[model samples]
Target: MKLSLGEIADRFDLSLKGDPAIEISNLASIDQAVHGDLVFLFNSSHRKHLTDTKASAVVMREIDCTDCQIPYLISERPRLTWANVAKLFDPLPMQAATRHPSAIVSDQAIIGAGVSMGPHSVISAGAVIGDGSTIGAGSFVGEGSKIGEHCRVFPNVTLYHMVCLGDRVTIHSGAVIGADGFGFEPNKGAFVKIPQIRGVVIGDDVEIGAGTTIDRGALCDTVVEDGVKIDNQVQIGHATRIGGDTIISGCTAIAGSTRIGRNCWIGGAVGIIDNIEITDQVEVTAMSLVTQSITVRGRYSSGTGLMRGRDWKRNIAAFKRLSNLFKRVRKLESERGD
Candidate 1:
């Protein structure tokens, strides 16, 4: 995985500030880097450590190079350059294009060229796996499911019947796609379960994190558009359509029938209620509860900031008297009127 500084600079369109022949064998943090390693300084506050770093080379902005003693590559966006560099050092092995002996593939299933099936994986009847895809151990691809080219379905992932995934999608371990949505009708002191008959359709380049679950729609397909990144343990409810390029952080819960717009950022642990429409480019901060539709695009937050217990108690008391205080102020203004 070694790369010369000149090669990295040319590939990433970065400016070379030092000897181009210097070879980088690995990547490490600025603090932990040894010789033959490349480090990056993305944060300005970390510039203080540049003078003392032990790395052979560094990736940084031109302004930060003044304090760097080692060979460095200049980039307008150092963090993004570092990300591209990290891909060169990715440790995951390439797919071998062979199925394990223990794998159970249905006779009616269509497996494409260069596909790899790991141990005990199942491909049900009428399923179609695209070229160069990898199905990891213990995964289950249900009947009529279609996985697109170069997708990776990690171990223990479940794609329920009729689910469709687009090209280059990555489903992490323990992810369950197209499970039944929660729908129950109240009847005479009892609850009757409603049938969830729809499937899920995921677009290209989407990465669903570990343990995340996307439920099938009750009447329509649950859709996730291209380039959406969903973090670990997130729950996307039935018939919800997440627009392209939305980023949903870990533990966020989006209720059924919600329409989230493009380029939106949903922070960690945010709760979005059912049937709400969130406009494009909206940003919902961490732990905020969204109960209504957002008509305008902007950053929205609804939660108290962290504070000491005693200060919180005082604020709660003041909040409880707000209505009465408003009434008293109105009366005082009425008496003073000329």
Candidate 2:
């Protein structure tokens, strides 16, 4: 996809400082771009490359436009403008409706127009696939499940019984939604399984990454509200209700019955204990362990930061002296008796 610098500037409403006739054929980094390619310099640290870059045009802020001979599209938000320009090149694929002969679709299933069911995919009895939705190769749509219009369920995804996906939802490969929740009781020295009776309800425009697992609820549905972005290899436990626009990063494990409020940011590798209620706009840093409910909106973190091995050992030793120090301080205060 080729776009002229003038066209891009006019469309994005950015001020142009270079020749308007220059054609941009591709996008590249400031260091990697050659002539006819578009590049970006959003960080001040990379400003050194401004004069040396071979890019035909650069997307940059007005301040960085100094001492540069090349043409540039000045944007207050260069990164955001660069994203818009990139979309002009790499647009989403619009595939025609296709259903392979190898697909196994039940007669009772309802499939709308412009649907694509790939080879060996299964549409169970009473399943409803909305228009313009694509079920990838070998994916399984469970009985009575509903997939909304324009939803994309990639290969090997398993949507268990009665799961509901809203419009524009994207589920990546190997994601298992509506799986059984980890619920059991210790009865007579044996663990008895509690029934996972409810399904998963995902809202519109939500994107679930690969290898993620969202468990089915015990009684009520496990609800993921609209515009939530979930990263790869994440496991969300059953009965968890995630509010709108929350971002969950990779390798995070949220325990069962947790209620996460809107716009929260959960970092990678974080471990949250079950039955917790985290309020809106809370941000948890990477690798932290959350043990209780977070009621206030703020950045929360646990786990020690990285340090030298000797320093870490010394810090651990110092913690052991805290109890003794408290006792001595208490005795001294009692003797003073003010």
Candidate 3:
């Protein structure tokens, strides 16, 4: 879909700074953009490339418009504006209402109007799929599960029994919802299996990335609130509650019964311990290990950046000696008359 600079600015409520007639067909980075393509500049460090870029139109902040050679759209947040405009060119695929011949849909399942069942998909008994939802090829909607309106269960995704998903939820390929949590009891020198009786509850507009696993609760529901974005390979443990608008990056492990507050940003590879409460608006840096509850809203980090093995060993030795060194200093101070 091609649009002139004027049309784009009008649609996105941005201000046009250059020739409004210039047309743009696609979006690209500043370094890779060419004529007829649109590009965006967000960081001030990349401003030097603006003079040499050949993009027909650029989306940027009003302050960065100076000396720019191309027709541009000025916005307060250029990156977000670029995302909104890019959607105009790349729309989501429309699924047809018909079910494929190879799809196996149980007669006991309650499927709503306009639902699409792709080839080899399975809809089990007592399942309820809401209006306009799409079950992609090879996907499985387990028995008694309830999926809400306009949801997309991508190819090879699995929704286990009793799982509930709200409207517009998207589960990407290879995601497994309602999987059993890791639970066990010691019995006579051996580990005994503990029953996992609860399910998963996902709210509206949540997107679970590929290969992510959301475990079923041991006794109560594991909940993911509205607008939560969970990246690939994330593990959400049983009975955990993640608040609205929280963004958790890839490879993060959230242990059981944890309560994460609203609008929190959890970076990649973070490990959050069980039963901890993280306050609202907290930011957990990448690779940090959270061992206790955080009551304050602030940036919390606990991990060492890259360092040489020899230097790291020396730093650890120094850290171990600090307690004795402090004791010696205190003793000397106490003995001094002044």
Candidate 4:
């Protein structure tokens, strides 16, 4: 899949600084790039390595091209241009339209045209699978589930009963949607299990990563709005409503009944407490412990930065005595009367 620099520049709308006839076939990092490989310089930290790269073509900002000797593609956003160019050589594999004999599709299920059902895939009674959807091996779509057009349910994925997914939704391998949420009632020292009766509703163009578990609601439907991107191993609790276009990173645990607003970016390993309301456009930094509701739309961080172990212990001790120290300082200030 080699393409000349001229073709790449024309396709990506970038300006070519060197020989446009030079051909590049693959993409690599600046440090490991070889002949016929395409490399890119995006961060200023990698500027020093550009001069020594052996790549046939380099995608870089116009300002960083002074010492670069290779055939270069100049762009305002080099990283974006490099990504678009890389897609030309690395295209997604197209799945063939076929239903394996081992697949168990119920007679009551309505399957659309061009759908591919792999081995051991099960579509339960009253399930509707839309056109061009591919259900991978061992995937199960429970009864009354509605999967929209062009959805891809990867291997071992499970959609429980009554789960509704809109068009172009992609659930990666080992994802479990519509699972029972953690709901219990305290009855005088014994915990009583509360029956989970609601379903999960996922909107269009949502891509859920591998091993992510989205719990079903206790009484109301758990909703994930359009264009929401959830990373791997995330735990989305029951009755939660995630607004449109929100991006949640890996290992994030969102508690039940929480309402997360639109376009919010939740970083990795963030723990959001139950029943909390986070407004739109909020950014939660990685490893943050969100213990309270965030009504304002702003970036919030709670995790402490890395430090020497001894220094961290000292800082923690100091932080604990801050109230007493503040009182002493106030008394000293009163005596000085300055």
Q: What lDDT does candidate 4 reach at residue 242?
A: 100
Q: Model 4: what TM-score?
A: 0.92
The candidate maximizing lDDT is 1
Candidate No. with top TM-score: 1
Report the lDDT of model 2 for residue 209: 100
lDDT of 2 by residue, 58-150 (tens): 888888788778888999898898788888888567657999999999999999999999999999999999999999999999999999999
What is the Cα-based lDDT of residue 5 in candidate 1? 93
Task: Give the CA lDDT, 0 to 100, for residue 5 in model 3.
Answer: 89
Higher-scoring candidate on TM-score, 2 or 4: 2
Question: Each model's TM-score, in the order given?
Answer: 0.96, 0.94, 0.94, 0.92
What is the lDDT, from 0 to 100, of the residue 308 in candidate 1? 100
Model 2 ranges off by over 4 Å: 91-93, 336-338
Local distance difference test, candidate 1: 0.95
lDDT of each: 0.95, 0.94, 0.93, 0.94
Clashing pairs in 2: none
Residues 99-126, model 3: lDDT tens digits:
9999999999999999999999999999
